[model samples]
Target: MTRRNRSGSIGFIVDDLNPMLRGWFNYFKHAYRTEYREIDGFIRRRLRAILLRHNKRKGLGITLDAHCQWTNAYFAELGLFTMHEARVLACRPR
Candidate 1:
């Protein structure tokens, strides 16, 4: 994945490619689109790597910011996480 600077351009590679995470990659592709392809790609790779690494290490209790409450609620509606659970998860220690 390529980290982007303030101007919104590719900064660098985050990791090597992995075919198993196509779905996650596609989600980022849709989120960032062409204007920020590099950044999106980098995030996809990085997130995939982090998830995989965490799984291998059996790490859990992850948390995230509740900045976008509506978004989190939507995700919960879609069965991603409960609102209360997401809030707690958002503050999980790294």
Candidate 2:
């Protein structure tokens, strides 16, 4: 996807990072066994932050959890193997 398109949608960003999800997940699991939930939450929040940045162009504002978009099954629905995938991905270097 083009840089413009990637910046416009969170889907693009996740899809773009798909190849690295496994490695990212493993790395996080191995490195931080205890902080998984917090790490996961950060990833969700980061995605919301990205959406917020994009929405600012239209002068519309939304909380990251607007309409309950962030949820327990979010990672699995996105093709992540485990709930901890969020934590792993969140801890990965940018």
Candidate 3:
């Protein structure tokens, strides 16, 4: 989803990504020791990179600034699926 020339809103990308993430999470939910946090972080980092590129900026300072601006909560608001949440829900007793 981090294609350099990809055009469209972040919402569009998240909409396309959600289903794939859900399917993958369902299939792998049985793995009790999976590092969902790391997976979520990786996804978020790629998303951050996309945002950075979209804004045509670079450098560690801008990257850190972006992190503060576009936080995980911001992505959640955009409906980006998170593996960490999936893990929590999957582990909950019904």
Candidate 4:
């Protein structure tokens, strides 16, 4: 997803990758009995990662602002924060 960028809407990228992602999920589900929710969450993280990668090399504040709604979970996934820290962040008002 390094090929994607923040220069335009994400709809086009999703549209382009939908078939490949579906195929991957199908293979995992059949070969490993993966849970739908797990695969779904994984895909969400992947998409988020792509966005973060694209948003990198910019101001830290801008990067964070680009995904404020994704903060705690995202940072936790990156090991930038512990789960407890993320939970506390989730509990705080914006």
The best candidate by TM-score is 3
Q: Model 2: what TM-score?
A: 0.53
List pairs with backbone clashes in candidate 3.
none
Compare candidates 2 and 4 on TM-score and give the better one.
Answer: 2
| Residue lDDT tens for model 2, 6-93 | 4745666766655565565666655766765665566555555565566653334445454276554664466533436556576689
Candidate 4's residue-wise lDDT over 1-94, tens digit each?
4243534444455565566655654455435442554554555555565566665634433344555656546534443312233334545799
Question: What TM-score fits each model?
Answer: 0.25, 0.53, 0.85, 0.40
Which runs of model 3 end up more than 4 angstroms from their true locations?
Answer: 60-62
Put down candidate 1 lDDT per residue, 1-94, tens digits, no spaces.
3222212211112112233234444454444333343543344444433443434533342233222322333323433312233334545797
In model 4, what lDDT does residue 3 have?
Answer: 48
Model 4: residue 51 alpha-carbon error in angstroms: 0.8
Show pairs that collide, candidate 2: none
**Candidate 2 or 1, higher TM-score:** 2
- The top-ranked prediction according to lDDT is 3
Task: State in Å the error of residue 78, model 2.
Answer: 3.7
Better of 3 and 4 by lDDT: 3
Pairs in clash, predicted candidate 1: 1-14, 1-42, 2-42, 63-89, 63-90, 64-89, 64-90
